[model samples]
Target chain A: MSTNQIFIVDDDDAIRDALGWLFRSRGHVARLWSSAEALIAGGEIGRCGCLLLDIRMDGMSGLELFEWLRENGHDIPVIFLTGHGDVPMAVAALKKGAFDFVEKPFNDNELVDRALAALDIHHQRSSRQAAAREVDERLAQLTSRELEVMERVLAGQMNKVIAMDLGVTMRTVEVHRARIFDKMGVRSAVELAQLLTARTPKPD
Target chain B: MSTNQIFIVDDDDAIRDALGWLFRSRGHVARLWSSAEALIAGGEIGRCGCLLLDIRMDGMSGLELFEWLRENGHDIPVIFLTGHGDVPMAVAALKKGAFDFVEKPFNDNELVDRALAALDIHHQRSSRQAAAREVDERLAQLTSRELEVMERVLAGQMNKVIAMDLGVTMRTVEVHRARIFDKMGVRSAVELAQLLTARTPKPD
Candidate 1:
């Protein structure tokens, strides 16, 4: 059982206090922030597990804060708490990668469920990102020429064809192929193709 | 301007013809199969993209076919085309990882949109899975003792602390840390932590 902290960001003192109490009663550590600015100013961001953000806040709106965090490379998952009129905005946030949106006066269980789901997703995203970074690091080990060979292999070019295309001898291609396999640690072309197909482009 | 192929699998010739025409007119290459077995036997599975699978069939039920493919490690994205009374089965398919479920007599545009979304997701999933395999391969290069050290370092333990815990000399810990960084092609502990945290465990 993972113990996760929840950060509640809402202007309404009553709502924040109530949620904090509720989360604490459920064995979660809940921290209440009166506004997005307060949460940002506090600079205690990474400690909380996930965020419960109100759609409409005074200075920095929830959506704006979300955008800010995303641009700055913070991938903490957020679940939006929205008023009835804010459904469209919340939906837009979902498209922009908000985990889930709960309408105002949400069922307590439903909100908790959404929060838990958001945490699960955040965990998954974090895991995938870590894995991606590892791949990037390994790919960095290849020499420029070896990387060229890899690109050809990933593009489904046969070794003889790659040798001809790169104007290298077949033996050279074979040597590079062995090195590529050793460096990438892939046993076969199919596995290598699978890896290439799934690689996300590194940020520029 | 992403180009994707759509595969329509159904026993009904009319539905297949209709969907094929619809997809083709929208600039997609649509390939029709008369049955799940036919589609599998055709061996054109990897060529023309996302699947439009009909739920009810004579030999293999769409759900069963989906489960079989998934079990065999195929990640081809599928959108279930169901009849009116098959809504429950469709829902169950969605839970089982079908990209989307649509009933017959569905809006043409809606189907197209869902198919497009499923294709995009399939591409992303395939890419991510490939990248993850690369990470797994690189991690596999570490010796058992090195792996234990790497795990502790990634968990944010200092080298001295790790040495004490592992009952190794501090100099030995330093040697292991250097080898880990060199093998993993990582420059810093923070980056290594990020890499380790981002990996998803294979499903149990």
Candidate 2:
């Protein structure tokens, strides 16, 4: 796994510096931002990493920032730092998919452990999404003729019928079939069907 | 991810045949057993992929099989197939780390979807373990003296201190440090330390 860049968004200079020093001492690179605007303006969201966000800030609350990020399609995993009165808000944020929350004056180890786990999960989700995109790209590699044949194959159609429907010879269909299998890394038509079905976009 | 061989242990021959056919049609190899003893006798536990087990079998119930597998250190993911009355048992199995449970007469699409998700997670976990092993192997390549220097570097020790502790010149420590960075694919000690700590074993 790659080393993650942690962005800490907190208003208090003391807390920011303390946490930053703690992370640095533990061999982690910590970037501190005093406001959500600074963090967003920094353009670090697209990069694979996590956010350590304070629940209450001067201008933009952590929950508001989280909602903003979500509305803008930012998928970075967030660990919210909450105070005693903010626990309910934090719990609500979790229901909306905040990774985890740490109450004020939390054990350093506990916070770091949750941050690390969130980072791991974030990486895994990114990798899975990448893999899904790769699958889509590979599926795109087929020619239109091959795609038609693939659809037929997925529909449990035999090569003879596919060839007849396309006004092609059985041998030609077989060749295209082989190419499709090779491109998709599938052994049999049934497997290809399953993969195709899984990747097919569903109607909302 | 490497494909896994699923073992389906259920007393109902209909259910067994249906699941076996489902997996086989999807290009996965499945072994169906009517009882726990039969599954155990078939092969070593390590060779088996995940287990699709029924909660209520005549001889050995799914819970018993799970307990036995845990006692023997067989850590394969087990997804239980439960009847209408077996929801509590299914929940208990999940608490014990059984992957997930589906009730009898479950939707085929939902069941397969959950199975695929579970397999993906297992593959990721296995991949992480392999990566950790690779890290261990690379660390092993370092000589005892090199290991000492690397540890000191990870601890954020100065080159002069590391040299003094290892009874080497500062230049020698610098040379070893460069090699360590190159070998670990890290630009700095903090990055290397993050990689090392990321894979550290944690108590459950």
Candidate 3:
């Protein structure tokens, strides 16, 4: 479960209240904002899983707020509430990576489904991000010499060969390898290699 | 460069001709079709990098055509040509993974720019798909026993330890390791591991 809120930002009071009730009826926790500025100052921007924003707000439209979020490195999934004319604006926002948009006369069930999908994407993205951070933290604990030994170990090098290549004694190479495994919190070279490989770039 | 043709599917002859000139003016080879049915029958799909499709046509609308392409496993990036009334339909198509939509009365330069971006995405996607297929082919060539040896070798096991664990002679283990490396087309265990790792699921 994401444990993140779904945000609904619209200038219209009726739309906001309706959307809030709509999300709540479907067992989702939603935070409603009367305007984009109100949402920005609400101090809950980056913590949300999904957003349903009115595309054509009075000041600082939904598209502008989405740009702001991207500029500040927030990648929250956003579904827009669009008027007939606002479809073009929605298209532009989608190109900039807004998740999806719903035209004004939206079906309650359909809107709920889209929001749930957005939340699922957020869940996946956040989990990968969390995993990457954990890997980074464990990697940061290793000394340069230990990292070098770990690389050789990952390459299936025998300790004797690694020692010879590094111009170090076999005993010193073994000590470095042990510390590398300890810092990486892996029981074997295979486990350490798997973790590190997942952090590397994909094949070109 | 993708070296793939850009497809333009629209019902109106004038629109198709205008778009053809616009694309050629931007140094792209575009194949134009009078309708969705015409484009489908043309059979140049599954190879194109991008498409400009009018949202509404006399028969087999653009959305329907997009659905057909998806069901048939073609993932071409499509930019929709949408009239005012077709905006909602365009939004629905986008939700179904249509790349981007340009409302009717579009700027030729902007449309050309979006099409070029779609081509770039296609290049990256096709490259990755090619890499994955190559990996699968190599893995398929290995026998089950060689695969088992390959796993331990990737784990950085010494030949002596692997032979003992697998109840095999040291010479036999060395042969299997060499065969695994040779079959995978890599000189070292690290290169082999990196190639295989990219095919696995991302970190959870």
Candidate 4:
């Protein structure tokens, strides 16, 4: 990921400026935007950090921007900044997967704490994606023949049986097996199977 | 593990009774109590369900009960019921791992919806724990010798290599390997390895 960072989006100059200063003082690269539209325009789309969005912005409302982020497959954790009347909207957004919301006049400590928590979640997700991508790249390196041998090996098939099924010599199957293991960066079929299985998403 | 259920712990009799009727109407077996102490006395500790707890109770406060539940290793998702003044407490409890909170005079539909959502999360966690338990049971079924063979198998060692390490013949290693597969309910070493890997928890 990146260093602990926070995106503060609010139409009000005072609130956004104050939040930016608060987060920056805490050693975060606080990105201040007057509205969600400006945030998108600034090309902060795929950054790894928590977002502090005013629930009721002048343009591209925070909730709408959150919806857009979700639709576009972004998983950045969001913390909504809300007035008392907007608490319900913030709560509704939470159901739709916003990390949390801080009521306006939010305690400086509390808001900063929540942002840090969201950053932790962002980091967790980023590393998991990186790991999955690494595995995928390795998998993409296997030849068609190596891939076929890999599947049978993972299925616990013996070399002779796999060779017969593919109408190839045992030695040919063995060679493919070695190459599959090499490309997968695994010393054995069990390790390769585990490498893939570890990335499987559990039902939520 | 059980049908959709909701545990309502509130000091107010009317609120508890109303919530009970509401959940029962939704086909949930709601267990309503006037206090957290009553619920604990009723032996609902290990039940799989959503807990609707009022932040302030007569005997044991809702937050106290939540803390107790956590310290005792109970993980039923909790939703705090708060009045307007209690929002801060509810938010604090949320930061401490409460599932969510419903502000009072809360919309009935939204409250029930949140509770059901909590139940969905409960079900997900319960199933994951059950899967890990099943794997543990299967692992416990292995004899010491078979377990040694299983470990080497998962490590991708060849039968001949395992035999040499165990000071056994190739036939002996083969027999142990087959028995380990049978006991683990897997057709292949790769399957066994994947089963174990799937239960591994990712860093959070």
Candidate 5:
């Protein structure tokens, strides 16, 4: 049972207390904030998990806080708690990048479920990002000539064909191939290709 | 066993035949094309699969083909097959949206494994897209007032609170709530919130 963290930022004490208790009862780690300002003051922006925020807080609206998080490169999935007449704002937030929004008087079970789903998304995104970073780091270690050879090798080109294409000797291509394998820490071309294709580039 | 489809668009007969045999042996369905023109003429855009295209073809270059695919909204993951001295072009293609590129004289096993992985990516992307479409269709069914009520109700607001916030009678709010539920085909606020949160919106 993973104790997924749930962050709640609402101005109302009762609402915050209710959410905190609800999440805790369901085996999640719950952290509460009285308002968006308090959440910002706490300095936990990059924490991996889900954020439950009230759309119309006293100072620094949820949308404002959401923008700040995004601008600062925080990818925490946010579910906004909207007040009456805030549907348009919530929809705008959805378009802007909030994970989802629940209106005030939301169901405890639904909110908890959504939070869990958001946490899962965060985990998937971060894991892929980590894998991509690893690939990028390994790729950066290759020289231009070695990189060219690596691409051809993964394409299934033999040393002779690669040599003919590059107008280089077969021995040179072989040397580059060996260096590429060593640098990428892969024994076979199949392993190298799998690493490159396994993770899609992160969306902009 | 799932026979994932692999699309091979290369002018070289030997290369295409080799890739086709390799993928088929690995239990994948391989479709071969001699040129980008032939692929476009076939009208197979938007198909759920992966594409292996040669970068420098006879008539249409791989980069040109990839741009055409993107312009027409084809999301097929494309892996380019480049010839000697095509590393620069391959790197440019990768930056421009091609999945990954392989050099000429490519490895059969490496290419096959990469194609399989790309096919898996296509499947995951398309399924998520289908789910987002479902949610958008459901959301479109609600009226403005009903949408407002729906948002608030999903926020867990009571009828009385919603009525007070919307400056409407409690009975009116209740009527709108019933109509919203009927339109959205959901029984409770929890169900509604879950339905809305289940799919992330497609990125622009």
Candidate 6:
């Protein structure tokens, strides 16, 4: 399967086969694993796709793998394939960053729908990361003094106060501020702050 | 006071009175409070505005007021006013839902600028809440059966499956789904879900 394939990790052979057939019918591909260990052995970490993981398996429960993925900073979304009794654990996983959980005896369409939403979330997070990286690159283009002025400006410092703090003339501070704004592509201090702190809370 | 008023709460008359003068000269009014008790007495909890609160005082500290406001679901943005030793407390307040904190002896311009940003956050949050309320109102227009169909549709149920569960024909389910899309002003199941869950997170 390609990197975009949905990775299914469940010890139940029937579930794995059923999910594989369901995804295929829906014009998508799924890579099924009999266990979490088999999934790890597949060398699919860091890929940009969703994981449909069974909550309770013989070994390495879904929650453990969820924590492990978080610690590794892998940006993939995870959907827990949980049974009815596993809901509290699934809710806890949701708090810890799992995308969504589907109970066993779930509607096939419901599972697929959630998988689609999880994929969208994954793309959004990836795009935000890319945008942040681009912003950091632009930020690095400023001179050291300009960077200082930008920080003070975002801190709501006036030109005179910034000049005094940097031991420079008010005109000099203004010059640096103008250059910083130009390089940062922001017209005002508020816009600059918004750009610098672009990491807003994502909708769950 | 104008809608842009910075509501100032401080036990020290000196600080409250000084800030009142500072905000006035900056073309914004200040609603001064001698204590958190007086602030609650003023009955301004539900208003959309920015709060400038002294982090430490004799009774009902700013942090306590912050917690109370949050527990009561007050949507106003709070900016803590802190002394040197109160920095850590102010930091904790920020984590606990404060917009930002200004340290003493803070520059007048810096404090006002922060208050302006806090007001913007308040407005954004209010707008998001308004949008959510509007969505809820639209949802209320649906018939009981249409509502059920919508729930099933959003859960990723197929028309045939929904019809089977509801003991209706597939054509009837399709008709209900179409009416749901029309009433909700959404084009697809994904769009409908997004509209229904359109609550924006508050800035931390």
Give the poorly placed runs of model 2, Cα more than 4 Å off: A1-3, A71-73, A84-87, A164-172, A185-204, B1-204
User: What is the iRMS for every candidate structure?
Assistant: 13.7, 19.9, 4.2, 3.3, 25.2, 20.1
After superposition, candidate 3 runs with Cα above 4 Å error: A1-4, A45-47, A143-177, A187-190, A200-204, B35-43, B148-174, B200-204
Q: Fnat for model 6?
A: 0.00
Model 4 per-residue lDDT tens digits across residues A1-204: 353667888999998899989988888888888988888888866774889888887768888999988998787899888875343554466657778877888899988888998998888888887888899899899888888888788778999999999999999999998888888898977889888888776454
Give the TM-score of each candidate: 0.50, 0.45, 0.82, 0.82, 0.46, 0.48
| Residue lDDT tens for model 6, A69-134 | 788777588988866433234335554666766678779997898888777777767777777777
lDDT of 1 by residue, A80-150 (tens): 78674332354356557666666777788867877877677767666677667777787889999999988
Evaluation by DockQ, superior candidate among 1 and 5? 1
Clashing pairs in 4: none
| Candidate 4 vs candidate 6, TM-score winner | 4
True lDDT of residue B113, candidate 5 = 71
Q: lDDT for every model?
A: 0.75, 0.76, 0.83, 0.83, 0.75, 0.76
lDDT per residue (tens digit) for residues A1-204 in model 5: 232578899898888899899989887888999988888888875564889888787889888989988988787788888666232354356546667767768777877877887888888767667777888998999999998887777555778999999999999998998899898887655456556645445333
RMSD of each: 12.7, 18.7, 3.9, 3.8, 27.7, 20.9
* Candidate 5, position B112, lDDT: 76
* Reference-based lDDT, residue B188, model 3: 71
Q: Relative to the unseen true structure, what is the C-alpha lDDT of residue B134 in candidate 6, on a scale of 0 to 100?
A: 82
True contacts kept of each: 0.00, 0.00, 0.36, 0.54, 0.00, 0.00
Q: How many collisions between residues are there in candidate 4?
A: 0
Model 6 regions lying over 4 Å from their true place:
A1-204, B140-145, B171-175, B182-190, B200-204
User: How well does candidate 3 match the true structure in TM-score terms?
Assistant: 0.82
DockQ of candidate 1 relative to the true structure: 0.03
Query: How do the residues B119-176 of candidate 3 rate in per-residue lDDT, one tens digit apiece?
Result: 8787877777778789999999999999888878877788898999899999999899
Model 1 pairs in collision: A127-B198, A130-B198, A198-B127
- What DockQ do the predictions score, one after another? 0.03, 0.02, 0.37, 0.44, 0.01, 0.02
Q: Spell out the clash pairs found in candidate 6.
A: none
- lDDT of each residue in A1-204, candidate 2, tens digit only: 333878889998998898888888898778889999887888776763788899889898888899999999877788888664332354356646677767777688877877888788888667656766878998889999999888777655678999999999999999999999999987655456545544543211
TM-score of chain A of each: 0.79, 0.78, 0.79, 0.84, 0.80, 0.76
